[model samples]
Target: MIMQVKNKYVYRSKISEAKFRQIVRLFALDLDATQISQIVGLSRVTINRYLMAIRERIAKFCESESPFQGDIEVEYEVDESYFGPKRVKGKRGRGAGNKTIVFGLIKRNGKVYTEIVPDCSKSTLQSIIRGKVDTNSVIYSDKWHGYDGLVDLGYGKHYRVDHGKDEFVNGKSHINGIEGFWGFSKIRMSKHRGINKKYFYLYLKECEFRYNFRDENLYLLILKIVRINPLFLS
Candidate 1:
């Protein structure tokens, strides 16, 4: 029997509607493919396909609902974090071994946006900030040279805490919000052991979606996204 999820019909599925809904609900609860397979009585491969489909929908939702429009006027925290296996021996921050660089921006008491970047150089970071953030907004960050000229680039103010000097917060100038998100993302992703580099961005986008809708009902939200954006099925 075909199941109607929101506005679309689930066709060509061997499992019943209740079982498919169970799989999707488990996925929203952050279960891995293996655990979901065991719980849903499906093969691991089938569960993996369902998980990928969910991730694809999340990616599309994030892209279509991106909050970076150069109109954010609030206390914004910005930071960069590396994601990958720990380096045995090498420089840690910035030019670390082989890790993916993710730049993040978060408005205090608001949503967050993250993007995979080639590097955290001044030029690269500045370009993204200029496009995403609004002018005359106060920006906070750690003492990274990449964030150096934000005020000069038209921000209202730029505050930084020198982490190298063991300073984390100075009055209200800190990147704790965005940094906290980095920690949260890493902890969630750790459950999967490791994701492929090729599809790392999709998983990363999923993290962003989760964080953005942390306070809302995510299962219903996922249904809404799937219903509104049929392109996600492609």
Candidate 2:
């Protein structure tokens, strides 16, 4: 039995590893609570119970530090992706909307560090860079005016590909990896319409987790899941 904060109640179930796997698979496939309940022949209340357990479990997965330290390889890219809400019909430039800003740092080879940010201001983006990246690494990004000041933050190398002038590359200066990630993320979100903003970060964390560890064995993955949060099991 477990108590979930969002849904007021305690639920008891003899859920197994296989059942948990099905739950995740269905979730990744974008099935909602009603659909998942019907597919699993479980009550809506029971399905929500399992989903809460899964969320709490995945939150624990982030406790372990990612293996990458400092700059990744010889090149790295940083970018921001906005989601949740859009500018009203015609308005633009950070006007009031429900949008959430997310920051990402990706190695040329595809490793990434992602986070939910309150806004895309220079200070906010710099804080993330300071925490996750080494100052000695070369950073690549589009010619966003805010990022122009990163050199003052001690980044030894900075490169910009001016998208405004079609200068995407001069050699190794492009943000393609991170751009592709944002595209994939937006596409995934679009397929599901819109996600509840409160739960948006959780979904982003899951995507990064899956993208970074796509090659592990099924049993090993299950072990990782168990380790992610055994509190729910307890």
Query: Global CA lDDT of candidate 1, please?
Result: 0.82
How many clashing residue pairs appear in each of the predictions shown?
0, 0
Question: TM-score per candidate, in order?
Answer: 0.90, 0.79
**Per-residue lDDT of model 2, residues 172-234, tens digit only:** 889988988888778766765778877877678666765666564533563457544443433
Give candidate 2 regions above 4 Å deviation.
1-12, 16-18, 24-39, 70-73, 94-96, 218-223, 231-234
RMSD of candidates 1 onward, in order:
2.9, 4.7
Q: Give candidate 1's root-mean-square deviation (CA, Å).
A: 2.9
C-alpha root-mean-square deviation, candidate 2: 4.7
Native-to-model Cα distance after best TM-score fit, residue 114 in candidate 1, in Å: 0.4
Model 2 clash pairs are: none
For candidate 2, give the lDDT of residue 100.
82
Reference-based TM-score, model 2: 0.79
TM-score leader: 1
Summing lDDT over every window of 10 consecutive residues in candidate 1, give the lowest-scoring window: 4-13
